[model samples]
Target chain A: MDLNTVKERAGPREFSPADDLPREYREAATRMIEFHANSEIMGAYLERPFIRQAPSIDRKLAFSAKVQDEIGHGQLLYRAAESLGVKTREEMLDDLANGDGKFLNCFHYPLKSWVEIPMISFFVDGAAMRRQATLRRTSWEPYAHAMDKVCFEEGFHVKHGEDILKELMTGSRAEQQRTQEAFEEWWPRIIQFFGPTDDKSTHHDFAASVGLKQQSNDELRDAFLDQYIPKARKHGLEIPDEPRIRERDDGTYAVEEGDLDWDEFFTIAKNDYEPGLGQINGRKQAQEAVQWVRETIEDDATTAGGHAPQAAD
Target chain B: MAALENPADLDEREREALETLLKRLADDEFVLAERYTEWQVRAPSLESDLALANNAQDELGHARLWYDVLEDLGFEEQELVYERDPADFRHATLVELPFEEGDWADAVLRSYLYDAAEELRLEALEDSSYPKIADRVGKIQSEEAYHLEHAQNWVERLADGEEGHQRLQDALDRLFPHALTLFEPVDPDVETDIVDLGLRDATLEELGEEWLSIVVPYLESLELELPVSSQVDDDTFEITEEMLPEKRGRDGSHTDAWADLHDELTHTYRDLGRSETTKIMEKPE
Candidate 1:
């Protein structure tokens, strides 16, 4: 509602809006917002293990701040989606923890390395920012307003992440190896971050009708590839697949469709619901870790004359 | 740079109060700051998240300064901060409770209650025999005033609007008991010792009572109930230094929350072995 969504999409290219969008759009928007919310929440679990293991005061401080930001963002976006009447935050989590729900392609995958913190901030947050910035002009008032805030913060995270990567790349030879290992670990998933490119995927129409997502998968992936390739290479970080990454003397790169890895993308997306140990096991583990705190909140709430809802829904 | 180099200039009573007060200040600020950091990535939105994180950082900075003063008084910072058993901690029960991860209102309530008590305590310290600390407290008070104002803004905004006020009222009811406990007695004998020497302006219990009078009126105006409390048997207050394990937390008693918190908190630092020095901050540029 704030920015021009129709103009941007048309300028980039045209795609058919699902016919009779009023109903379908709302359904898909609910699902998409839930997925993004889950991504933000689960993103914490992936990165959290490292904060305790961080090697320095600065690392601890930075990671603490970073994970906190991730969780915080999830809260914000969930509330935004709730404002749109798509889903309640509690319901979204119930769907995530219990019912079938999908997050972004990036989160269901694993994360390793301190370097990945910034890389996620750089590459992933950068990609995330693209989607978010566009959402800043989203047709839905609440989602658009929320994105404005999300985008501003992501800018800082990206810069901080870039600086970390920049230092590692330009640091000593040992730093180079560390940087490379970090790059290699996250690169495949990063490639999948644009999400699988499908014109008529099952969830597509549902998304557009409700104002959940504007850009097609391929469109966003192309935008990401176009922006990130040079920055990745500037630090001598390899793209790993030359054919997949189009290079130009003019200094930009394009994603070759054939080279794009959809199997990995789908594998990750499917796992967004299932995780790797399976959703059942992952759900059990997450529940156990939080059970005591949950119980405490419930018990205290009752005694205090107010209580938070405990039902999965 | 011990440039504030003069002897901390407290009489025995004030000097003793400094030891108890600063640790209470440090631990209270430190732990709440730690808990608040969990909200960093998961806050309802990035701007709000960033704002809360900045507040967390400010608490940590305040903790570090308080600790610096402790170290200046010849105590080792690490031992003073980490090694003490829970029972030895002087912090109130308010700072120790576990947080519900995504509950922004809970976080806001924590801030509002803590900020109110913090302002009260710092105001009392402003005229203490410890000049250096007084000066430092004065500067911190201003920044903390902003934090309190921020908390008040949210409280009034949330509490004034429809069902919003109920949610805030609920949080206040839950956390207010601990907040009241925050003002309970610290040292029993210090009042006579410090007042006689002009080191402290009032006795610990007296100050607690004074603290109540100042805050209760404002809280009443908001249509909120103040936690019932008196000095030692302070009605709403039950926590004391003797409850903690005698260490880093006030009198050191802590829940399992502290361990989970410390693990997440120290994660990055644990890897950077003590032998290596890592840069803590980037140049301002």
Candidate 2:
């Protein structure tokens, strides 16, 4: 299909792999879905350490399940991206490991302690879920289908994260204080999760025009702030004064875009942020270490006729 | 032996036998699950990562169920896990050994060996005189079936290629001796009590023999060597005393790796000075 025809026909689940789409449409969807797939992986990498560090068996189990779900989401999304025929899963993952792939800005920063967990799990994930809920109607059928499963499993994650927040807020003075401090530190980064406002975002116009993106950055950010600002207060976490947020007459919230560190966001966007490079290389080392295993399995799948049982001794 | 239904009325000997058996079961699952989490995001593929993570959660859930029974004897999750001495753990040393980086072979081979033994052990507990142990076995065994199948599939595929076969060989040789510790006795005398009191229908030696019969033939079929002798066609397998590791975990002796793992898993609990562990899931009904 031509660009004009594609733009006109864009609607929920309108596009599939069978379509003879123009290059522009395919590349745009691939870039958007690949970024999303990369984010799921990077996000899981960030949360993995906490699986070992969880203070309780139940919490550890929940964290492991959540991280596993993120990897599973990555799997679904890569397939969705691959459906565009623009890139393969291996290439996408390799780009992520090589620091050439871009993901969400929040994942670039390190998550240090248990107190910082709910910051990512609750606030960051909450923001992502707000955006993803809209993408359930995305023009790419596979991407939207993947979103169906992602949205189903993500509710548990957001709730589990919030549960951690609730626990920390009600904990001892030291625990509560530490959690609040973590909130203040992470608040700006969480706000940046929606990315720059509509005017500043480079790809938003084409993506939305094609129906791949259902809502603008400004709309998603405002929606997230409205839902989560009170949650922070209800949990006794004082919203950081900076990234000055204002409540509108309709009671929705808006972040002072000037207050967020866009330079840092863009640096992370370029995969040049110092800490993010560590994350990228760390995952790369892990992937490289397991390269032999992947090769072994891949070779076996091709060579073996059909999983014939090993000859009995 | 009659089923021992009430936890309150057990005498000293019965209590010791029951508690010792429970610790052995719980510690094995808990520690193995802890090791399995090392593969969370680092496994060979995303699908593999998810599979291993699911296995980790399954084993941990089984550990939770066993630990819950110990609470009937006045143990709390804090005392049972977070605050317990590493040396006090009664898991086989095989589960505690650290995974070599990029060693998918070790992960799969270890799972195959451990899950094979686990199937036999759980079956022995299926008719335990301790009613709680018997009741919980069915729930645990159902999940364990998938673990064993998953492990076998991976191990077989890994053994197919030249390099994978060698990797599987190396993993098997290193892991074989430690795997025998699965059947080591906590106290030789208490082991006898476990059988006599009907806490498990099979003795450790019996379970060990059955495990060898299954795993030896399976691995040898894939051209992997065992550290012990097995005459597969004749239905005879022997596990000599020398084949067992010096630090058999069942007796509260463990490799150095177990201590480091224990410290790491408990770091958060200790870091947060508050006294208790949190419970997110409702107590397993």
The candidate that achieves the highest TM-score relative to the unseen native structure: 2
User: Quality of candidate 2's docking, in CAPRI categories?
Assistant: medium
- Report the poorest 10 consecutive residues by lDDT, candidate 1 chain A: A11-20
Best by DockQ: 2
Q: Is model 1 an incorrect, acceptable, medium or high docking prediction?
A: incorrect
**Cα misplacement distance, residue B82 of candidate 2 (Å):** 0.4
Model 1 lDDT tens row, B249-280:
33345556666655554443333223332445
List model 2 lDDT by residue over A1-313, tens digit each: 8999999999998999989999999999999999999999999999998999999999999999999999999999999999899999989999998889999999999989999999999999999899999999999999999999999899999999999999989988989999999998999999999999989999999999899999999999899888999899999999888989888999889889999888999999999999999999999999999999878766665676645222210
- Candidate 2: Cα lDDT at A205: 94
Instruction: Please give the distance, in angstroms, between residue A43's alpha carbon in candidate 1 and its true position after superposition.
Output: 2.9
DockQ of 1: 0.17
Residue A166 displacement in candidate 2 (angstroms): 0.5
Please state what fraction of the native interface contacts candidate 1 reproduces: 0.25
